[model samples]
Target: MIDAILPPAVVAAESFDDPPAELFPEEEAAISRAVDKRRKEFATARLCARRAMAALGVPAAPVLPGPRGAPQWPAGVVGSMTHCDGYRAAVLGRAEHVTSVGIDAEPDGPLPPGVLGEIALPEEQEHLRALAASRPGVHWDRMLFSAKESVYKTWFPLTGRWLGFEEAVVALDPAAGSFEARLLVPGPVVDGTKVTGFAGRWLAERGLVVTAIVLPSAGP
Candidate 1:
């Protein structure tokens, strides 16, 4: 059985242990296998997604794979899922009533080298560099990485295309524990062209960094 932790709607977190069976057990086992660690990570993510849907009063539907290796949620609901080392989290909301939501969690650690150059937009890279220089020991790099992943999850479902790190600019307000992301060059994946804003927050705790993002709802 999976364990779930839920908070109120403003922000929430959920986690669960990996299940023994792969989410889809009926399919023929492929000759090549994912590393043990990745399989565990996938199980944890699926487990959290189920619990999160239940917490949000959405259907706890079975995990189903969709194009580009993303999970497919039941109709009328929007959500995001993520997992790292030992924890997973999912955030879901009624897209008709609430805007798009994205959630991500990762084990806290030193930032991977060159990560900033890859993910931060030009202005954002300069801003974060200055901030890091000003406060030498801060974990701004990790926070920024978490923010980027959250932004992608928030944007991908609505746009249906992969977004590059340079295309999205992130601005963080440390005092408020919040951040905002803007899509600079709408990529080939997005259509209809109305999504213009992204914003979110990051919380660091117990060796983990968690962030969430909100995008406007696609209306009827």
Candidate 2:
């Protein structure tokens, strides 16, 4: 399902059930004190990540969290991972072909009361309201939140900076199953260029809402 949204250069792996709790020594150290549920999720997400790595012909390595809880990928690789109830996914691409990748998955449900207002700007809220009225089947609020997550995930690796929920103004296209985020603050510089915004794709299906943003490499 994730592969459908990503480009051909990216390799994606997903699983619906938790695999056996297994982790490298370094990975185990990262969550040594966590509860069983947290351990399981961490282990399974790494499992999916390694699967993507193998597809990219890279050796399996521990995907430890770097600053701000972002996965630390191997040199020459860019990737992201996300997990939710009954779903875990990882997507990876070589740095030569893809500059960066970000992915997130969430339960296809409404955000808890009062949470939407906090994450969404006024204009985004107005747009979501219009979407809900016209097409009430999908949870536009959650989709918007997921899109922002993808935007942040894509931004951090490039800038090593924090992106608040209100920092990026997102617009979702229901018909295209795509979204674009316009940055409020200064954007990241990539390949001698400043990135002002990011465009990504979203999917709402099989009880999950998934979003992804992939920035292609600028050739030398």
Candidate 3:
């Protein structure tokens, strides 16, 4: 996923085909009261995240949920995580070189009726129909939802503001296997510059739809 979407220097990713069943004490407390299913997902995501951190030479550490339920990474690390049926992944990059990151995965399935109306703009729905007409096989509605989620994950850490699904327009390029999020609200400042949009990559394969966004550090 990292190689398909990000520059080699910008990020590294780790994934789990089999989710671990154990959770560290701290990680357990992170979702101590949640249901069994929630706990498993929580623990598995951390396991993936820790491995990603270790691969970057960072010490083993607990990734606890922070404000807005975003995973809090150790100092000097910027990363993201996503988990879906049978798939979980984490991507990490050095804070000095990467500003923020967001990743998401979803089962390749149709969005519930009326879901597209809620999450998509008028133009997006039209384009989605075209995509479905041509591609026909991929679940473009669900892919759009996942892409919007990835955008929010990338945006919140940068601006600390809420961005609704309708607030960001996602345009997918099937030819390039990527997507771009056009921010409809005031954008974030990166490298001292206010950028209007973000670039992301998406892939649909192996019964999953995955999307990622990496904001490389605008160096100080």
Candidate 4:
């Protein structure tokens, strides 16, 4: 039932385990059947997460459900998850003692012109301009969209607040296989959280874009 698959990384991963017809339980409900596609999307993400942890030699700990429907990792592990139209991904590391991590994947597509203005700050707009000039025909909109979602997944658990797109700035360096972000306002998710230089990569093959965020050990 799980036809879609994520690429093999050093991390632990699984195909859809929940029903193939739907990713999440039917009780969760979807606005439309198409949204149900995300069920498989989410399922694969968790599977990949488990695999990624195992690859790291981390034990097979339960993904405990947190108060706000977030996945809680085994003690000493820090990680994050995300799923889009066709793919899902997760990354794990030792908790406070190890490092914080986040991952995201998005389909390549056009970005509505209006969205670029709405979500991007002035500096971000400039950055996008350069991306566009360099990679004409590539959708900057989609890139920005995935970038912010990656940022949220990377920063939110630490601060626990929902983030807005404009609140942060992103700088991408395609040549180096990485990008950077600077979160301006904290909001509830990462209050006063100054992530001056967060880095990540975009894997174009296998129809997936991934990001990995690592924070210093915020623990004993």
Candidate 5:
């Protein structure tokens, strides 16, 4: 599922079932005080990450969390991790080939009541409503939340700033299995000119929704 959106330069690992891998000591130390579920998810996500590193030909090392809880990748590497029930994935690329990457997975279900109102702008909600009207089976609201999350994950490393939900408008094209997030702020400077938003791809299957974005062409 994750491979469809990634380029050949990117190495990715994915698991539909938990693999028998333990957390490295440093990773364990960071999550030691957390609940068991959190620990399990962290360990599993790292397992996928390790496979990605190996595929990228990087020696194994501690993939620990940084100040803001984002994974600290090896020097000259950029990557992202994502996990949800029945799915976990990691993508890695050389820093020269990609500026940043973001991936997320979620259960294919509707957001809890009123969540759409919180995370979407008036125009965004209207768009979602139209999408829902056309495709009644999909939970477009939840997809927007997931897309916003992917947007932030992709945005932060590039600009080192916070991106509010209302600050970006998401438009999803179910037919194409893609989405675009238009920034409401000054937006990040990609290449030379300031760009409005990030482009991403999505997949909804087997009761899961997965999204990914990579900044390869938009150099660092």
Candidate 6:
């Protein structure tokens, strides 16, 4: 499901079932103090991440979280991981071919009551309302949340800065299955280009909403 949204430069691996809890010694120590559910999710997500790294022709390594809980990748690699109930996925790319990657997954359901107001700006709320009216089946609010996650995932790697939920305004195109996040804060510079926003694709199917953003390396 994650592969559908990412570019060819990215290698994506996803699993619907939780595998046995296996982890590298370092990875286990990172989450050893967490609850059982957190441990399981962390293990499964790293498993998916190793598969993606192998597909990208990189040797497998323990994926430990760095600052802000972002997965630290091997040198010369950029990637992201996300896991939710019944699903986990990882996507990776070589830094020479791809600038950065961000992917997220969530249940295809409405945002919990009142949560949207806190995360979404007023303009985004109006846009989501129109989308909800036109496409009643999809949970636009939830999709917006997922898109923001992807945006921040992409943003942090490039800038090493925090982006608040309200700092990026997302506009989702229901027909295109795509969204764009315009950063209200100062943006990052990548490959000599200043990135003011990120454009990504989203898919809602099989009871999940997945979003991905892949920025390619700048041409010489």
Judged by lDDT against the true structure, how good is candidate 5?
0.85
* lDDT for 145 (candidate 1): 83
- Candidate 1's C-alpha runs over 4 A off are 1-13, 16-32, 133-137, 187-193, 216-220
Off by over 4 Å in 3: 1-3, 10-18
Query: Model 1, range 1-220, lDDT digits (tens) per residue?
Result: 1112222342344554666534545221421277878766766676666666776677657665566666677786777777877677666667664556677777667678877677776788788888678755447777788888888877777767887777788887776778888778754332355666677877767677777775544455
List ranges where model 6 is wrong by over 4 Å: none
lDDT of 3 by residue, 1-220 (tens): 5457766645454464555556668877778889977776777777777777878889978888888999888999989988887777788888988888888999999999988899999989998999999888899999999999999999988888888999989898888888888989889778889978889998888788888898889675
Better of 3 and 6 by TM-score: 6
**Residue clash pairs of candidate 2:** none
lDDT of each: 0.67, 0.94, 0.84, 0.60, 0.85, 0.92
lDDT of 3 at 170: 88
Better of 3 and 4 by lDDT: 3
What TM-score would each prediction reach against the true structure?
A: 0.80, 0.98, 0.94, 0.72, 0.94, 0.97
**What order do you get sorting by lDDT, best first?**
2, 6, 5, 3, 1, 4
lDDT of 1 at 215: 59
- The top-ranked prediction according to lDDT is 2
In model 3, how large is the Cα lDDT of residue 189? 73
Best by TM-score: 2
lDDT of 4 by residue, 5-123 (tens): 22223243434234332233432343234464554555566567667677778865555446465677777677777666655556666653434555666666666668777888888
After superposing candidate 4 on the true structure, give the runs of residues whose Cα lies further than 4 Å from its correct spot. Answer: 1-36, 59-61, 64-69, 186-197, 218-220
lDDT of 2: 0.94
Clashing pairs in 5: none
Compared with the true structure, model 6 gives a TM-score of 0.97
- Candidate 4 TM-score over all chains jointly: 0.72
